[model samples]
Target: MKNVNYINESKEVFDVIVIGSGITGGWAAKEFCEKGFKTLMVERGRVVEHRKDYIAEGKGPWDFPNRTKVDNLLVEEQYKIQKQCYAFHDGTKHFFGNDRDLPYNTKKGTEFSWIRANQLGGKSLLWHRQSYRLSDFDFAANKADGHGNDWPIRYKDLAPWYDYVEKFVGISGNYDNLPQLPNSQFLPPFEMNAPERAFSQQMASDFPDKPVIISRCAHLTEPQKIHVELGRMKCMARNECQKGCSFGAYFSTQSTTLPAAARTGNLHIAPNSVVESLIYDEATNRLKGVRVIDNDNLSQREYFGKLVFLCASTIGSTQILLNSKTNKFKNGLANSSGVLGKYLMDHNYNARTTADIDGFEDEYYIGRRPASLYVPNFHYEPTRYHKNFIRGYALAGGAYREDWQSYGYTDGLGINFKEKLMHPGQWKIGLQAQGEMLANRDNQMTLHATKKDKWGIPQIQFDVSWSDNEKRMMESSVEVASKMFEKAGFKNIQGQATERPPGIAIHEVGTARMGRDAKDSVLNGYNQSHDIPNLFVTDGASFASSAVVNPSLTFMALTARAVDYAVKEVKNRRL
Candidate 1:
């Protein structure tokens, strides 16, 4: 187990100080530590040890006191926004951030549900783990459409880094050879059940343009020597991942990167340490250290580092940058471009389509597969773009026969009704569209001038909303998906367009984007600040665009690539 400390003081100026020990921070710490750098990871939440801290792991729904339902009073008071997430349950409520204690403001008319997991692992512990690689189609979307700043780097630049991270993370997938969704270095893929196989074949036969494949995820389907050495095992397919996986089957900070970083014996962790802002030295033209607040007592402390990586969540990192006001950059640190908090984006996941399949009653599957079936974006290719919307969206779902779980919701009274539901019900399939949200400068966030949190940090005020492009894209996805289901001879086909606001996807990005020009973007292609060469922000905050696929895998890839560049530059004394 990684020995983590919750101290308020440190004497040494560390080689690297990684803020936010989540996905990117874990990766940065592991990479930097493995390269022999004295690294310190600061997290605002309690230290949750692997296996020991997964309190609800392996427990059934009936095991919970409230039957996996969070208390209503607590939900109303602290989790009003987080409750919207499907994964928020009694078993996993401890992992979510208490919204009452961590308040933020949104525009009067607009609502953004900032679902957060502000723990030692951040959202890495609660992430869906559906890992996908972005392609050139995603990298060039902004340049082609003229919606946002152009991506400084392209797919080719990050492809090797994706492979490096995938090999260590143990991604389970197939080589689809699709241009829109590139393939990763994959382990043995989890098998498709009977109904899913039938649906995949049928989808291929009916519409070759939209191919259904197994969702690639960061799970150890087949543990490699390295994974085994790390004491991780193959995925048991419990699908109870949100509560935490004691088996270490999934990729999380505790299960994967934290241990690796600790194995180097060069990592020092400060849990319950919330970073207030970065301290910059005007004379040196480099970041001096970070200012931190104790999450429990609100005590202040400082930790200096030669290099700093801000791996906080999109909004959280931007809030830090915006709050770190200085005389040289009066607006905000690295805000000379005046675009630090603009062009916010998240996945538009409000649309859904469901239908009932005819056959496959006798073919039920075993074990709960954590991942669903994936259909990469069929529209918005390099050679073509959707007429209605400039960007595209991906579809993800699975085919499953209703089991005994469905009986719980039905109106049944007698023994016959119980016996009837003992057998499997009809096969049902669903396709939910995760559309691309175009970047809009008007949709932005800023720190409140007067409001402050208990820790003396300014409260973030969000003013982001979906644009017409997102609405059109969602409608187009529903139309395309519903048509596909209808042509497949499915019954009771239903299509829906939701009114749920942005940030629900929890794939927020693009507050501090990367671009070629420092006048417009905050970071360069390497995720280093355009203004401060030694400072980096490699998390979702550095995303130029929120592509159709899940962003975690891309974040890991970017972090690895950026760390490699940053380390080399530091060695050469160029940073």
Candidate 2:
């Protein structure tokens, strides 16, 4: 809620500058501020205060003029790309960026939906909140398949950081002891309804390799002293989280990290300051500062910092790096490896299946449970290799009886329909597959040559597509899901093997990957730029591959770990 205008303050160099205010940015700011560094967090969007700025929170469907639906005219004009996302609606549309304002081009035959949320909290306030830890299977995946750069740091290096982040964020889930999906330091898991329990039992019996459990989420199931000190409480199970949780029940930059960072007093937030590029000092062989563009006034300014952390989203960070060109680095800053905008990846999650349960009419859930059921990747082990595909996919779903609202689609007379509406319908179950997308060099994003945005930054152009492996994996997902539904004795089973174009999953990663060799990658194991020692990129841009899981948790772990390394290197004068 505290906005600091750096332009009015003395032009003194800060200890650290974090160029983003999203998930990783928030973490970086908190870590840096708590370490007693004078940290400045530069956010391109408007400041959104926790609880106070959630304009749509707690609003019911009937509260809106058009119910929960966004106007068709607005969608056609400003939200053509954003509307493709599943979360975009009347209540949450304010969080999404307008496609018309943030225009980008795609290849002739391929399409990449660049979903963006530019606000104080960024996508952290709008994410699905599903948090899962990546395993050695993901770390060793690139080496095993020779797809992308081999991850320099394995699961062991990140496990402790994951625990640290999970403890602070208050993840809620049970420990299943699955190697593929490591357990987090969690609060108690939410209870499942009768239908979900039955589905889990059937899945365990029929598909022993695939274990169904409660999906891990960043919700305060049981608020601890740390949470209470931050003015947060336990989740109320309202499930209208995308609108923002006024109760601070969910894990978001506004709800958690922003407040923690603010409490440190070393934190300084500069909102509406869009980063144009980094300022490189050839003499010092380091980044001197950052060039910032005022989002509204179109005026330019520069802020100096000893260390720079690029916590912007994958594409956002890449764009800033590519624009920060110097005489020594003709192509881009820290892009001597020529792999900056290549190896782009996203999760393939279009394939899905649904079925109707015969019974459970009497059963009903009390409140809106935010988390879903999760089935870990069964084909993650080396022994369980797919002939058609190299990687695996995870399944997220749940079973619930249809409520009275579902009666709108049923055929009935007035009296009969009124009577039937009193009773809930049969339980229905669904499973959506989230397959790992291989890191492909051709699936790239670059800046448009001729086009520039309002702030004089080049428009991003995307050329990404799904390969045969992804298509085959999607087919397998539908087939396996249908088989599971059939084995579970469900009726009217339906499945889909289709895959949406890249970026629909909102899990876009890679572009500036990490590896041991600087020739093939942009960053090192510590997320430090191979070319610029004092610069760090701790967001998804440093991912070597897009593992089959929601990536926010992994991003947080990587950011925390990178912060520790950066701080140590700075103190030791190694950077």
Candidate 3:
């Protein structure tokens, strides 16, 4: 990175300070800087330059000492929580936070896996990349069911932002035209294999309402002028994205927004700056600045800005807000509503079902497809009295021919074994459920009375857990998925539920949620804090509900939109 971009020990007050350089942070920085605002993006970890820092992108299995599997001892000691993530392995372990260094507790008898990727890029380097837009179905879900506070803004409010962000991010998806999952500004969608096409063909006959479509994602299927201008290329279908995509094929902090922000010459980056709290000015009733701790030396410093945008992932941002207890608002800054760290939510993804296919021996896909097939929510019966669950879930999976990893355990010798490994294993269909967890006040996180991290920041104690509504949703999702495959004439079908905790979904969102009322929510319609004029949170922390689809897309859209609004507000001299 240019030295100009790295602002260390700076006393100059910036136009904007964006905390967390993940999805939303990158967008906030990019949007603010491009709009002629001097922005300082604060990251609590080391800088990861794009292309240069993608250390594991092209390595083969032989390159790893343990054949790309993380060492057991290292995993057992430092990655106990991170190992639960699907993408954690030898190739990608460097991007993940060491569990030993980051400690927090959950309530006894309940578990929430708080996966951390505390690097410059944050979880954007480690996300699944499944991007979907939320409709009125999701925005009004709380109001329709009375489960949680109603979202202050609806789908129409975010649609234009989604269009703006998607055009730059390059989403690859079919315009399925489903009301539940609105279409994006799409690149060409990836093709489904023979069996998946067969499954899609038969789904309409079995379940008429549910839309079975190719999952939307942030991968660049076909590079557009905007993407090409940034040196991004088309998706190679490598699917080794968790290791990092140097090609900039997917939307990530490194791949897209960070570079966009850098080119404008208005963005400053502060790596290894752990935010301790927000400095509140009691007399002015605004945030004076941010209190930061150096990640390595434990030295303390402060960064002042006219506006503060908290894009720190759900838990990280909540910690800052809760820890920033001011004399004016004793609990936390902009936390007068007392809802800063309540209503913690994650997708309930504990249900899974897989089945064997008898034939299609000649059929296969090109280069291990990256995207999955999706079954949109089928059980959202608002008018009628239902029994299984209140909210809904979507199932995502695909049929693929297994490689050596699936059958490598079998005993073999010499050339015969080598020849067998070259051949693909039997085809199989796998599906898993991702359901919405209601925003119950009980599912929450609180600052521990005594426990603090090495930087003297209070550790978040998660009291979040799945309720019966989630369990019922899982059961129903599995049944529907199994029946879909069964009706498709697949053989050796096996369907069962899983006993996994929250955060394994890697989509844990909510804590400082957006709502209509100032008394019950932290953020307003434009992601501005309800109490503080210059404070905004645009990451998943501001999510009112954990909608079934992947949330990174919406997080990006909200961040861009929030920055737009904040810039205008500042120009108008209102903030």
> How many collisions per candidate?
0, 0, 0
Give the range of the ten consecutive residues with the poorest summed lDDT in model 2.
1-10
TM-score of each candidate structure, all chains considered together: 0.98, 0.98, 0.98
Between candidates 2 and 3, the lDDT winner: 2
Per-residue CA lDDT of model 3 for 239-345, tens digit only, reads 89999998999989898898888888898989999999998888887887899999999999999999999999998998899999877778877888988888899
Query: For residues 76-102, could you state the per-residue lDDT of candidate 2 as single tens digits?
Result: 999999998888899999999988888
Candidate 1 ranges beyond 4 A from true positions = 2-6
Clashing pairs in model 2? Answer: none
Predicted candidate 1 versus true structure: per-residue lDDT over 334-417, tens digit per residue = 888999999899999988999998987668788989878899988756456677778788899988888788778888888888
- RMSD vs true structure, all candidates: 1.2, 1.3, 1.4
Order the candidates by TM-score, highest first — what do you get? 1, 2, 3
Model 1, residue 124: distance off in Å is 0.5
